[model samples]
Target: MGADTITRTNRVTALAPWLLVLPATMAVFALLAVPVGSTLAESFSNPLGVFENYRRFFASDYNRMVVLRSFWIAFATTAIALAAGFFAAYLIAGSGPRTKRILILLSVFPLLTGVVVRSFGWMVILGRNGILNNALIELGLINAPLSLLFNQGAVLVGMVYLFLPLMILSLVGVLETIDQDLYSAAESLGSSPFGVFRQVTFPLALPGMVVGSILVFTGSLATFVTPRLLGGERQMTLATLLHEKAIISFDWEAANTIATIMIVLTALSLVALGMLAKRLSPKGRA
Candidate 1:
């Protein structure tokens, strides 16, 4: 009887927090769940009131390529951002207080600005008459103007620029939490600065890098604003195609299918990251 009573008490304790969370949970169900359910339903629903949209996507090569490009672009963007952000984050982490603050501020400055404004900045920097081409011309580096805008190169640059902040912030959180003693110990044993970083700093920073890469990858995968503004016809990502399907072509079914694929990939990546972290945690502790 006493054990039953204690179980009841624990159940009530758990229920109390859930009761407080009920309203927020209800709102999430209404907002996120409803749209996602609708999309899932639509993905399996045919335009003619049957389930054919999904079949069509799987059957179409053009769509397969478009979706593949989206995933590829996102993967590439994430890798480059992670590589750059890791070094940048490490440099900032080892800096003094004031310098760290300045570096953090500089990292987030791009994120503070509006997306449209950033797109325009890319336009100015990569245009035919842009500063880079003009400087090259003046230096007699090339007789003809180099085309940088409206190409794969422009799309990648813009994607990396936009996604870099997420990487830096993710890395900063993990880097900040690391014990300085580890580095000191490594150095005391005669490890060079770069060697210490390679052995100690890099391993410790892996979790953050993994997290940041996932963020950048997901953002780049579903990227719409940056790619559309920066890329030409050859640079159409899955997101652009989805947008076109929904808005221009009025093909919501195709759009929903694309969205479903993106969601699945993102969820899988997060799950993979979780499993990886679990595997790595024990090694660090041991």
Candidate 2:
């Protein structure tokens, strides 16, 4: 074949995969991109003008507090999930096949239940006349209900419960990928359990931790049903505020602006998280 023919063939081969995925890519674009683009356009085309919705978002004290509160809840949920999930993942990683299967099934059972169902379940357990209050009263622990169902604390509990499985599953995959030989080698080198984990296992698992953190944080940030149900009207996060704006107030422009801000923040967080993961990797350290 001529050089031109060879080059054309090479180009065609390189393009083949893209060709194969083109249909699915177009479907995704239609489903996700179109809606997002429409929302963005609507936000800019509001009566006050292109930047008006965003101006209100930034300039309003209530809007600013909602943004800050959303991030704060997400951060707290991510931290709590990571702390609990790391140990659970380690246990599952080292467990026998049957034990691992059972643990994983149990961990993921909550996901099978709808978020509304789970939130209601929490309400049943945490409400003033709920199970916890009844138990406490019987035990003489307190005379009155502790008011656990309509605050940030309840939201934290619900969010942590919701996202812990993701963290555990992500960490478990990473932990399982670490060669068993590495642990044996560390042990042969007189490393204790703590030393092996701190020096060898943790460094290798940092990527998973980073992945779990991002997932939990983003999930928490965007969750509306749980926060709204559990925190009631007392707490206002971005997601809940967006819901109120779009549904209750019929303020499409404001809602679209909030959605755009969330998408941008989520994208920025993913990039920053990926960079942080690279920095914490063994190769990055070396």
Most accurate candidate by TM-score: 2
Off by over 4 Å in 2: 1-26, 46-49
Please tell me which predicted candidate would have the highest lDDT against the true structure.
2
Quote the RMSD, in angstroms, for model 1: 4.9
Q: Candidate 2 on 1-286: residue-level lDDT in tens?
A: 8999999999999999999999999988999889888987887886777888899889999889889999899999999999899999999999999999999999889888899998999999999999999999999999988898889999999999999999999999899999999999999999999999999889988878998999998889999899999998889888998999999999887899999889888898888888888877879841
TM-score for candidate 2, residues paired by index: 0.87
lDDT of each: 0.84, 0.91
Give the per-residue Cα lDDT of candidate 2 at 139. Answer: 100
Clashes of 2: 0
lDDT score for residue 266 of model 2? 89
Off by over 4 Å in 1: 1-23, 47-51, 192-195, 280-286
- Candidate 1 is scored at a TM of 0.85
